[model samples]
Target: MRTLTLVRRVAPLILLLVVLAVLTVRAAEQLDNQDTYFHLRFGHELLGEWSLRDPGSVSSFATADWVPTQWLPQITMAAVEDRAGLAGVAWLSGLAFLALALTLYVVARRRVEPLAAAPLTALALVASSSGLSARPQVLSYLLVAVTATAWLAAARSGRTPWWLVPLTWVWACCHGMWPVGLAIGGVAVLATALRPDRRWDRVARGAAVVALSGLATLVTPVGPRLLGAVVAVDERREFFSEWGRPDPGDPRLLALLALLLVAAAALAWRGTDGPRGPRTLRGLRESPDLTALGLLVLAGGCTVASGRTVPVAAALLVPVAATALHRHLGDRPAWTRLEQVVVLGGVALALPVLAAVVPHTADEPPARPAWTDPALAALPAGTPVLNDWNLGGWLMWRHPQLDPVMHGYGDTFTVEELRRNTDILALRPGWRTLVRETGVSYALVRPRSPLGRALVDDEGWRVLHRSPDLVLLKPPPGWM
Candidate 1:
């Protein structure tokens, strides 16, 4: 009995420490995501300029008036990068990911035993892994986890979460997903109304909380204009792969699918009464808290909506799934204070470990070579370079002096510019003319791309540098 008791006491700390170690190592493995480049550069520019409007100077092809919706985290990242370089940014990312894991576990442990809560939390992390990059979106994910937990608690306690208003304000400044939190609040209000002991006063107060949260978003630096920025991105979703449909074969999606299935099975089993089972569908309907059911439905919708929302769905599902699985284990004692301290304290030590490792491991961008810096610096400022979409952010950050014709920021380009950039890169019928019109004499792109092949084979551009991954080519003399 003593051995079993000791094992239970030590397990939670072990679980969190293992998670911290895994996430820290993963986050420290080189900075390669294309958007991370532009975010850091933009953050630095915002620090210097103190503005939310893009200068429209980062790329020569940007025709849209871009609003920087994700300024707060960008500025924070820029400050960290300035003081400690990219390693600091990696350490910061490790901290954000650790916070996310701890938040999920703490919330789950409130209603579920530690053993049950731990696995459910792990499943949610795996489901959310695809969206866990070192970007402002990570902040949004953390806020989503908080929002879901607060609303779920309020659903049972019959109290409104007034604190969510200020959180929404901070979330708006950090990322464009503040509205999602408000939507969950709205759902919670409806769930409160559906309870068997529903109180009209509680329902009204819940609605007020959601209203105030929405209003809070309007007060951020971008103010009412923030809504327009979010809508603009949605209108141009075709150009962004993140906005595409969730792939059925993605392992993250598979994890989420398994989680949803398990939660549903648990709910179904709970409604049964031995061999007789639930007398009617009505029993099943009233079996679980309406708030949990509503959140699960929301998770399902997010899962089907697009690839970008999978993490949101996973966040929404964790608290409900943990509690649902706990129903099978019967009632258990809540975590002791010492147990909480051990788990949290161990997670905290990850920061120092990450600080030591990241500086060495995450010093360079993955796609950039040792020779890239000197080669690009040789070109004069304002020299137009033909580059594919993937290379645009790197050039924008490392060599803002040279203008690139296309980049990954979809909302910054007009519809015509986006389609034209695609056509040129794909080597469509008018690609040659489009390339010439840009006045680009230098090309930095994949050697195997259609544009690269056309420039070398048909236009006879000379290879200035060659690598298996990328090639630098110069147009024939007098061609520009």
Candidate 2:
């Protein structure tokens, strides 16, 4: 009878684990992180020509003092790329996702039973799947989860976590989204402070943490102004849609909404007896600080306003959901020590089968345009060429001689500069003359672009070479 009961519990756990392993593997294979080549350029620079503090002039019009917002991770990617090729890159990404899975499970298990935690953690992965990649942001996800767990641990004891100060410094050096950590730390602290029975000492400690976390962000090569890179694209938010509002159709957004509703329902009212406190507080018992809910609003608001941050909402709300389910999660069915080991051994044996079932590929971003190479060979070194927004990094890495117009770093360019580049692409008024003004003598683009179509029709710009997707065009000799 006990053996049959263990089977009933273990089957669903195995299924969910299998599903999670497959999804995470597929996510690594399919999504090609578009801005990778952009970072590679900086990474290559770090390898030889320049230090972290000195970003060399490889970008098209590299005037505005640049910042490597993802300096540490980019350097890591470069080192990995040098040793393992792109396959290693995909594998490395798989490892980060694996680490994230372990972290999520440990965090979730603290509040819910393994039966509940497995699927909940799996759901969190599904929600963040859309945004998964080898980018520096991956590191931030890990950092955020770890920081939240640490803060909660410290909050339980009512002591300030001095360790966060150094961790924040590391976070700042790693990614531009470092501010998110300080914001999270602040929210967690404030929530603890608002507890009705909390002493003023706890409140002071929380406040001290928030302050130090903020200061820790300044421990970078660029110092306090490093955060300025985060808002660099604020002037032209229209250019980067990810920074804009979430699309109603996004799979992650739907997953987020579903989980949120379920978590709210689970936490609404529960205890050994009956009715609990506020529904808005994410169902935490005997606490009205509403701190967790406030953090949700900040993360959720950003996700709603900027579709890019859905992963952050995923990272945050999952832990909250687990906590909400704490009281509701029933105890696991009884299993002896040997029975537990059998379950673990069986799941371990199934992993290889799970891996084989999942498809794998090296789908990379800024996807390789067909004609780029032949066209690059045809052009001479130092050619002032206007390139595709996504193409710049690919070109930058493959042939540094071909001066790039622009790439993924939105913060690197001024609003006017970005507008001018877009105007040329759209073939708007003064588009032809604007090319001359910017000293752009050649254009390398997919033939389907508006500028490519215009170049084909115009007598002034001649199509020098053609590939199925890309075209190389040069202006009349006298035009420049």
Candidate 3:
């Protein structure tokens, strides 16, 4: 009996430790994405001025009216990088991943046993893996999990999560997805109001919570301008692959589809307890949960919207799907106090151990090729250089004295600028004229890229530096 009690307490902790270990090792890998560098640098800049104005000093082409909707995470990353360097940033990313996992489990556990909640949460995380990175979006995803859970809880208890109003302000500071939280609350309140046995007071209170949350977003440091920031990327959405509709070939999309089907099956099923066989319309007495159904509609909309929203759709659906599965499988006891303590305590202890291992294990951010650094350093300050899109972040962070033609921050550029960039990079028609018009004297691009070939062969440009990964070229005299 004593062994059984001990096993029950130890098993959950063991499972949590394993999950944390896997996530830490994964997060410790090198920051390969260019956006990570730009985000870090932006954070550093934001830390200096603490404003959401034109960071013209950091980027040569970013619009002056730019908004920093994600300033909070950027500042946090900057502070961490200042203290512990890239390893610290890497460690912070690991913490965000772990927090997301825990949020999913805790919320799912509200309606189901750990057995169902744990596995469903794991599946949800896997579905969200593509969106997870060392970027501000991860923070927004974590908050989305929390927001969905809070609304679901409110639906069951008929008590508004008034706290979400202030939480919305914090979300606004962290990322541009603050509207997502408000939308979830709105859907919940609408569902409650539509219920056959609805209480008007509960609905009124819930609506107020949602309204206040929306108001909270405008009160962020960026003020009313934050509203436009969310839509700023709309014009450049075509330039980003993430903004496209879902590809059927994606494994993550398939996982989400499976979960949705399961939830549908569970909800549609009629148990033996229901009145026997086919009956007249009057005999049909069962009513569906409007709140859960309303949430499912929101999830369905997100799934079909775009690739960027699929993970969000997956996050919103986990609790509802898990709860359905739990109901289908019949009731089970919730996590005992001992199990909860062991799991939470084990997670707390694991954090220190993870931090210790990060500095040694986390790979440093990529550096420029030593061979080309000297040549690049010789260029005059503010010298314009046409560069590969991915390398733009490196130039921004390490060679701030030089001006890069473009980078990954899609919202910072006008539609025309993005179109010109695409045309030039792809060597599209009139690209040569566009290049000449920019008055850039140098090109830093992939060795075999179309532009690199054109510069060296077609334009007779001089190869100042060449490597397997990159090539730097100078146009013939007076070419610009």
Query: How do the residues 344-405 of candidate 1 rate in per-residue lDDT, one tens digit apiece?
Result: 77677777878888989997777566677889999999888999899998888889798899
CA lDDT, candidate 2, residue 356: 42
Clashes of each: 0, 0, 0
lDDT tens digits, residue span 167-207, model 2: 98888888877777887888877777677766787778777
- Best-to-worst lDDT order: 1, 3, 2
* TM values, all candidates: 0.93, 0.86, 0.91
Q: Model 1: which ten-residue window has the lowest total lDDT? A: 277-286
Judge candidate 3 against the unseen true structure and give its global Cα lDDT, from 0 to 1. Answer: 0.78
Which residue pairs clash in candidate 1? none
Q: Rank the candidates by TM-score, best first.
A: 1, 3, 2
Candidate 3 local lDDT, 1-480, one digit each (tens): 999867655654566567666776778777777888888878888878746755544555544357788888989998999999888888888888888878877877777666566666777777788888888888777788788878877876777799998989999999887788888888988889898888999999999998888888888888888888787767678998888998889888777887677667665554544367654332123466566677778888888888888888878888777656655555546678876775687567557776887788764766567777788888999889999988887678777678888888876777888888889989999998999988887889987888888888888989888888888888888887
For all predictions, the C-alpha RMSD in Å is: 2.9, 4.4, 3.6
lDDT of each: 0.81, 0.68, 0.78
TM-score of 2: 0.86
Worst 10 residues of 3 by lDDT: 278-287
Query: By TM-score, how accurate is candidate 1?
Result: 0.93
Q: Which candidate comes out best when scored by lDDT?
A: 1
